[model samples]
Target: MKWEKLGLVCTADRFGVDVPTRVMVPTPVFVNEDTIRVFVTVCDKDNIGRPYYVDVDARDPRKVLRLSERPVMDVGTAPSFDEHGVVVAQVLKTRDGKLQMYYSGFERFRDVRYKIFTGLATSSNNGESFQRVKTTPILGGSDYESTFRCAPFVIEFEDRFSMWYVAGSSWETIRGKQVPRYSLKYLESPDGIEWPVEGRSCMELQHDEHGFGRPWIEIDEHGTYHLYYSIRVCSLAAYRLGYATSEDGLNWVRKDAEMGLEPTPGSFDSNGLSYSAIIEAHGSTYCFYNGNDFGREGFAVSKLIK
Candidate 1:
């Protein structure tokens, strides 16, 4: 697949936030035929993230329609699983007409530097506010993943939910900071909730890979699975978009060379591009993603170069 780069869409300052911060992971939620609401992770000066939403025209996604006055979901209390930050990974509408949000709860640790766990929230009102179902994490993988089980993307088919998330498999000490090593994993649930404690490995880690940022999937008309994610290398210290395809969701192959997206040498996204969110709307395909500085530089879009 090919993409046409579009520049930055939203900055935290537009939301009345301070400078030197970022707005990352702009995932689109279709509000209607003409409008789309992009949910984003807004980083604070402290480098903590909170989920926020902004409305944009579907015909021209860069135009701002509205912005959330406050965070749709905030960080948890002290000593809580998400005390440090909460990054919005996926939001899906259940069969019962409620929206379910799967997020990565951030926790800072002295031993490991940080740990991320999966958590859930539900929205009764369209796409406005959400309430946490519980404080405890919904995902508990192996000890390797004890430090991270995040970036969950779920697709419900036949009334059953299938999830693809990034799970840490190792930790590497890099220049005084603990960086995690992870790969893509999969799980199935009879309901949107109640997944097994562990997930089956989908995308294995490559020798040159440290971890993936987010895994996004979409079933094409031909029933082939399209997976888009970010590849992080410890040496690069930044992310670049990658892609894969599968006949069965369980088995996969990487096609990063075909992803056709990279940072522009002297652009806002030049530092890095990660946390990709793709949507098919208004007769076109567009991808929203985070740029350099982990979105401190803000979010941008890329149109399918069809």
Candidate 2:
């Protein structure tokens, strides 16, 4: 596989607010025949991320159409699940034609620096705004996820919704900083909102990987599932993309070297990459991903060339 870089689209600096430090995790929502909205998590200097979006022309995804004025939704109020921050991952159009949003909430703890959990929101106004399914997370601190559960991507088949998410297994300290080591896990729900607390572990870390981030999947016409995720290289101390193919969503064959993406030298992504989002338009499949600073430098798009 091969990809052609399309350059950066929107940046956190465009917000023009109090130090719009980062813009990460480019998730898309289809609006109309000519419009496709790309939702991203914009963070402040303090590292508190809130979800924002920009609309682009359907024919050319790199062309900017409009930018969201305020956050689609704010962080949960104090003593709630998402007091610290909210990062948007994936958005899916349900069978009923309504938009369903999945995001990860940030929380702090004494033992660890922070924790993550998955939450659900729905947009009836066609991705304009959303109302939370509930204040508390539907899946977190479950049997498989010892510390955190986050960066969820979901797909639906009939009455069942399939989810691929990252869950923390353990923690390792590197140079006096405790970094979380996470593995990929799977879950299913009758409806997109309600999910089981316990998930089945499907993918673990490689010998050189310390953790994993958001998992995005694409189902081709042949029904083959292709999974893309970001792994933290312990030695390099930077994130890189990985790939795999699954006959069933449960079992996967790893092929990270074939992911067809990497940091472009002397470019914004030169340092690392994370949170892969793919949008197929025209005669090309485009991938939107975060660069260095976990999005502080902003996100860019890549066109599939091979």
Q: Which prediction has the highest lDDT against the true structure?
A: 2
TM agreement with the true structure for every prediction: 0.95, 0.97
Task: Give one digit per residue, the lDDT tens place, for model 1 in 93-153.
Answer: 7767788889999898776668888999999886799899888788854554667788899
Find the 10 residues in a row with the least total lDDT in model 1: 139-148
Runs with alpha carbons beyond 4 Å of true place in candidate 1? 141-144
Give stretches of model 2 more than 4 Å off: none
Tell how far residue 130 is off in model 1, in angstroms.
Answer: 0.4
Error of 2 at 164 (Å): 0.8
In lDDT terms, how accurate is model 1?
Answer: 0.84
Clashing pairs in 2: none
